[model samples]
Target: MKPLNDVIAACPPSGIRRFFDIAAEMDDVISLGVGEPDFVTPWRIREAGIFALEHGYTTYTSNAGLPELRRLICEDLEKRYGARYAWDTECLITTGVSEGLDLALRVLLNPGDEVIVPEPCYVAYEPCVSFAGGTPVRVATRWEADFAIDPDAVEAAITPRTKAILIGSPANPTGAVQPRAALEGLVRLAERHDLYLISDEIYDRLTYDDTHVCLGAVPGARERTVVLGGFSKAQAMTGWRVGWICAPQAVAELCVRVHQYTMLCAPHVSQIAAVEALKEAEGDVREMVADYDRRRRVFVKGLREIGLECPEPGGAFYAFPSIRASGLDSETFAERLLHEESVAVVPGDVFGPSGEGHIRCSYATALPQLEEALVRIDRFLGSLR
Candidate 1:
């Protein structure tokens, strides 16, 4: 057999999906494995898509995407974060944050370049760097420290070849929202080293009590940061596959260049729907955020009651709870729980080596489902004891 591309072949499958696949084949299962908003795309957003489809608005948008969507995205960014982006040259609508992230990496990385990635980040980060022909230099963020990326660790990881820093807050798996000071420290680090910043803000609107500090809005970060955002988590528009990149004019242009040569443009209907999402979905977003806050309280409290000591999640809909008390590594704990209690969770070690003693459980499900899953999780822990 012919050998496949080395970089592509070397990438491991997503660990978050292992338990999810298992649960899918089972008749009675509670899955907290997938990192998605359980909420359907808001009614109005879906209706916009439907209207577009009916009206034959299926043509390809500009390579940079629909100007209207880009404008709305910029407007929303300015209103929400005081981050001003010149709609035409500084914004791009991507297929989703996934594509946006890939574009950002491609535009920035050269073969053998190093991108410092904070540990326990989203699964695709390292692989994306590899695919972009860059080296991924991982810096661990401790659960003990609320999974915050320590600037000291990040600084120590930097090297002559280091070109960028990739970060996600209200982060996946851990749900750690980096505080403003912490983020500023990171920005300083980037400025000191002349490094680019790739800030994945896909879960931006999914945050609970904490305010999401837009990295691009930071004083020293705007020119160097690539802000990846989307409608998936907040607008519950995952299936619509609409996301965006906000960056400096030069970087934005290069990203669009790669995007045009590769993805061409984001789906026209999806862009239209995203426009509607930006215009009319604030109430829907506020409602969803409030609900997620309620779930976060109940779920984190429930996790603590069951003997799993979890650091309070500052944002996002996940609770990354320590499983060390069970004397089980993350994989073993998550596997046994699935078979023993029919509750599925992602083994945290897959997120990074620093995640070895924990498991990531999403609380994006309905409150009743979350409560029931907690009960099963409690029983599973009891059996482990």
Candidate 2:
């Protein structure tokens, strides 16, 4: 038998899932590993899907998704972030941000093209670029720098092979939000180098301290940027798998061409539900955001009190705390914490080498769970010392 495609085979499985699997086999395990909101999809949004199903709307949507949904998405973007795009040709509903990321890379990358990615990012970014036949050139972002991308470093890494810069804000694992100034610098670099910007904005509405600065809304960025967002993090609709891509008309057309052959279309019921989410769920989203903000403050303070140095997470529901003082690397620390304390966290190194001394703990769980997890973590650290 022939071997599988080397690239696909070589791609590492999600690092976040290893601890998840371990936790599943044990009782009384406190998991802060998965990067998903604990909240269920809002009642109104779920009802929309149920209504569609009862109405016999189980068919596939158009390749670009329902027209009304696309228009509403465009309006949401413009109203929330000041970004503008056409619903007909410039917006495409995808299975999730995962699919949108893949489509963006496939459309833009040729074999051996290079994509600049900042380290300590989401687990999928590098592998997605590699699977798309592009080289993922990583630039390091330090814990000391709050994991923000340094545009000068990105500019220095560019060569003739460099084709794009991929970025996720309100980022997973790190929970770092790139400020407008940092993004402005990146946009200028992209323009000067004639490179594309793939902006992952899935957690746009999950920020706690500061407003999420949409990369596409930055001056001179909208034309060259592919903005990927979805109903998962904000609307708690992860299982719905409905996300969208907004890009320039030419790039978007090619994405649709590829998507039609591969995905055909996003689920019809999910599209209907997502429309309701965008339309009628703002209050639900606000309430969830407020709850997460409370959890974030309590969780970060608890981590510091436990002797782990946690930089405050400005956005997203994760806290990447440095565990170097524990005298164990990220993988070893996470494993021991799970077994000894029954508290589960993801090893930061799985994100990149730059994340070596840290572990990612998501604060999306209920406050009582977070508080209990912190207590267990403190005891675990005491035993280690």
Candidate 3:
């Protein structure tokens, strides 16, 4: 063939999808690999989408998003997170948090700019930074500290080329929530260094034990932070491809321009659904979070009983347990579990180098499947012994 962009060529296959594809080929496999809510989109939200379609609301919206949807997003942020964002100047609805991440990087990064990322995070950040022509500087979070961001380590990673710090609270893979103190410390560092803060709060509503603290809510941090959120996890609307970014007026204006060229506006019907989801699906979100909490406890307790060491996750739906004690690396452990026990999970190393000894098990599935998966895991562990 001719040639492809080196960045595209350098990207590896998605780690989360690899196991999911393998599981698809096997019969009766219980999958905990994908980090998606298993619940259906609430009927009210679905009805809104259907209503829009019935009313012939299929046309493209403004590049920034539907005005009403943008207004609802602003209102929701103010009501829920105590944050204020101008609908006209401070927000741009996107295809999903995935696009929001990309837009943030595209708008802010220049070639060779450095973006600080914490290790054992979601699989997207580093590659996204690379694609945006930024260098990703990873700082490791220790399991012994419950994976809290170490301020000193983050400070040490910053250089003159540093442009932004990427933070995902109620983080993926590890399910660690950054505490308010940690967030404040990071905000201070961003302020001191004059760098942007990309706060990925897609899992903000899935927290089990503590309230989610928005970085924008911190003093002086709002101006420098770009908050990314979506309806995928909390409202069971992953397939809808609805998300948004909230930034200060100046940055948001640039984001909207980039959004205009990349993918103009989120889908109109999906925006209608997302607005309804925020307005009426509060109960659904709570029920799903509560259910995930139950599954988290069940899975974590079972893993501990089987002699696997897993940290207590404060938020998000995943349980990242170390499988090293079982005498296998994470990749081998996950492969053996899928092939031998009919259970599927993501290997920890897929997240980053720091995750080598662990495996991420999502609790987004039903209770029965979770129970059965635990039983299979127990049997597999016993056989190892």
Q: Where is model 1 poorest over a 10-residue stretch in terms of lDDT?
A: 203-212
lDDT of 1 by residue, 1-385 (tens): 9998988987888888777888899978988878888899999999999999999999988999889888888988898898989999999989999999999999999999999989898899999999999999999988878888899999999999999999998798788999888899999999999999999999888777657899999888999999999989988888889899999999999999999888999999999999999899899999999999999999999999989899998888889999899999889988899888998899988988988999999898989989999989888777767
Residue-level lDDT of model 2, residues 48-145, one tens digit each, is: 99999999999888999999999999999999889999999999999999999999999999999999999988989999999999999999899898
Q: Local error of candidate 3 at 318, Å?
A: 0.5
- lDDT, candidates in the order shown: 0.91, 0.94, 0.92
The model with the greater TM-score, 2 or 3, is: 2
Instruction: Give the candidate order by descending lDDT.
Output: 2, 3, 1
Cα RMSDs, all models: 1.0, 0.8, 1.0
Taking all chains together, the TM-score of candidate 3 against the true structure is: 0.98
Clash total of candidate 3 = 0
Clash list (residue pairs), candidate 3:
none
Candidate whose lDDT is highest: 2
In order of appearance, the predictions have TM-scores of 0.98, 0.99, 0.98
**lDDT, candidate 2, at 28:** 96
| Model 2 Cα RMSD, 1 decimal | 0.8
